[model samples]
Target chain A: MSLVEVTGLTKVFRRPVKDPGFRGALRHLVSPRYRDVTAVERVDLRIEPGEAVAYVGPNGAGKSTTVKLLTGIIVPTSGEVRVAGLSPHRDRIANARQVGVLFGQRSQLWWDLPVRESFTLLRDMYGVPDSLYRARMKRFDEVLDLGSILPVVARKLSLGQRMRADLAAALLHGPRIAYLDEPTIGLDIAVRDRVREFLRQLRDEGTTIMLTTHDLGDIEDVCERLVIIDRGRVIYDGSLAAVKDDFARERRIHLQLASPVPLASLSDRLPDAVVVAGDEPGEFTVTVDRFRQTAGAVISAVLPLAEVVELRIDEPAIEDVIRKVYAGELRLA
Target chain B: MMEYEADFWLLVLAGLLQQLVGLAFLGAVFAQVQALHGWTFTEAVLLYGFASFVFGMSPLFFDGLWRTAWLVNQGDLDYALVRPYPVMLQVSGSYVGLQGAGDVVVATCMIGWALSRADISWSPLTVLVGAVLLVSAVTIRVSVLAASCAISFWLQAPHSGFAFAINQLGTLGRYPLTIFGVALRGVLTVVIPFAFTAYFPVSWLLDPGRYWWAAIVTPLVAAYSLILGVRIYHRGVRRYESAGH
Candidate 1:
């Protein structure tokens, strides 16, 4: 059975509709008005054990809302969600033992407590054995370099340090399933890489992970499957390789000629590719469909026009495809 | 818990000074009149001391309830919800107020001094029952505060305005219930029951013949308040919508 199952889950928030300023506030106090805002529509999802699924969407696309629903932070307005065959909202304590959660925009650490103290408190709260707790802490320190920040208070730590500590707190109990929402957000590249590496290790250890992030690098490095949400609905769901293959077929090839070659001559030589002028007089860029033509094919065609000095192939990144989707430049169903 | 070591002591000292000033005010009132409504100066002090003691004790243990509104408004309750413990227990035990120490000390001294001066025959059984009744008073106080603070879930504000107002109402319990008109007396008895926190237990202690029933029912009132408080808090938690998108 799948570790996580969600069926037709929807949440509609009743927001108080208010008018402008002080007068409106007084009027609202006398007679309040409300409107229903559907945060999550009928959404269905399933994740098997040891699977790493990237849950991605633009802002306000209901990614956080869906995580909240699955984690039992909020009750669903309709449908059902089960983690480890137990209803998360109905059996919260049992579900809690099975799942670990981290929100990038928030910290679960006790604000006034030191990082080590926070971990110890969490250890007690989750009833993690001493042996396992020590082992996990050692592992976290080796990977995340948590030794220096462990003695520092949570509020005093920098954003990167805090994120690292929070990651430890969330995973201290060694839960079977982990839900990380934007864990790499607001983190520097070095810290982001460390977190990504930790997630990779976690996935390799047979932990089911549902990662919600906007960072395409995170998706490429850690997740095998991709799920894209838009406007409280899933627009696309499939494998990461499939998304790259289907939408990111276009590749760019850059070439520097030993002699200055006219753009028209290069266009004539490579009829199937789109030839464009490069930054310098002796440079030219060739856009090709990898399916229709290869970099070797395009390079050989251009070699005859001028003495080739250097050549570089730019494969399309999954980021470009996902960005296009976000910008409405490309549509996927 | 020791994170606020200096601030804790400072706040405790401030609380002690505040209670001393309140005791001084009670002294001034008694100086003007020998007795008000058949209760002596010592009896009034006992009632006031009981109220202050309970008020102080609540913050030392259950001070986290005061942060309920802020947590709900800021979406901080998300952490507690995902944890393996009861949300109410986590929230109520989140912080300890140092000022409670001062309240407890001053109130204890007042109760001790008043009992010594007052002409009341004491026995081992009566003392045990009195101890139980005092504990029940504190429970009633804490539970009522928790239930009032839980109203923040519905208000959706960042501060416990309703709880603060209810706490202000508790100040009235420091005096005899006879001082208030019939409407407020009814409110303190049936609506919120602040009277049970101070007046009833102390009255029963001072005059058992007329008010023995007050001492017997104090435990029941405490139980009812505790049940109501826990029920309201959990019900409010169920309605928690969590702020932010």
Candidate 2:
């Protein structure tokens, strides 16, 4: 059975309707009015054990709202969400014991307490055993280098250091499932890579993970399956490789010939590929569908016409496809 | 608070000064009249000390509940909700109010002095019952404050305006209930029930012949307020739509 199951989940927020200034505020005070905003609408999802699924979407796409619902932070207006065969909202404490959550925008560490004290408090709250607690802390120190920041107060840590300590705090209990929302946001390349590596190791250890991120590298490196949401709806859900193969099929090959050559000759010889002239006399770009023709075939066709001096092959990236989707240039629905 | 020792001491001094001022005002009132509304000066002081002591518990221990408005408005309660513990307990225990330490000390001294001066039959059962009633009074005071603070979940404001107004009403609990009109008396007795925090419990101790039922009613009021407080807080939690960061 799936560890997490959500069906027709919807959340509607009722906000008071007020105008921009003092007069409007006074008017609202006398006769209050409210408007209903639907943050999540009719969304359905399921995740099996030991699967790492990337939940990605544009801003205001309801990704955070979905996580809030699944973690029992907020109740849905309609529909059902079940984690480990129990309703997340109804059996919140039980569900919390089985799952770990991290929100990159916010720190779970107590603002006034040191990082180590926060972890100890959480250990008592979650009832983690002493042996497992020590083991987990040791493992976290190795990957996250938590020893340096453990004594530092939460409000005093740098963004990168706080993220590292928060990641450790979230997974300290060895939860069966981990829900991480934008866990690598605003981190340098080195820290981002470290976080991705830690997530990969966690997934390898048979922990179910649902990761929501705007960074495509996090998805490619740490997740096997991809789920894209737009306007509170899941528009695409499939394997990462399949999405790349289906939408990102075009590959570009840039070539600089030994001597000047006619662009027309290169285009005619390679009929299946589109050849464009570069600024230099010897430079040409060939765009081809990898499914129909290989880079080797394009190279061979170019070699016969002109001596190849230098060539560079560019594989299609999921980043481009997702960017186009966000820009409304490419439709996934 | 440990990081700012000077500020902590200044707040402690301020809290102690406020209680002393209230005591001086009570003394001035009694100088104008021998026994205002049939209650002696010593008995009135006991009532005042009882209310002050109960009020001090909030700042010293349950002061974190005062942050409910800020937490709900900022969506800071998100972490508490996801934790494997009661959200209310986490909020209540989040912070300690340093000023309460001073207020509790002054009120404890006042209670001791008043008991020594007041004429009452001493017995082991009476002392034990008085301790239980004092605890009940603290519970009632804390529970009412919690329920008031829960109003923030619906208000959406960063400050607990409604809760603050209700807390102001607790100041009247330090006086004898008979000094006020019936309508105000009903409000103090039933609406907010601050009267039980000091008046009723102290009344039973001072004059059991006429107020014997107050001891029974005090604990019942505490239980009712506790249940109501917990229920309102959880219900507010259900309506929580976490703010966007």
The best candidate in terms of TM-score: 2
Q: What is the C-alpha lDDT of each candidate?
A: 0.91, 0.91
DockQ of 2: 0.67
lDDT of 1 at A206: 96
Interface RMSD after interface superposition, each candidate: 0.7, 1.5
Every prediction's TM-score for the first chain?
Answer: 0.97, 0.98
lDDT of 1 by residue, A146-243 (tens): 99999999999999999999998989999999999999999999999999999999999999999999888999999999999888998999999999
lDDT per residue for candidate 1 within B81-195, as digits (tens), equals: 8899999889988998888899999999999889899877788867997888889988888889889989998988898878999989998999999999999999999988899
Worst 10 residues of 1 chain A by lDDT: A299-308
In candidate 2 the C-alpha lDDT for residue B136 amounts to 89
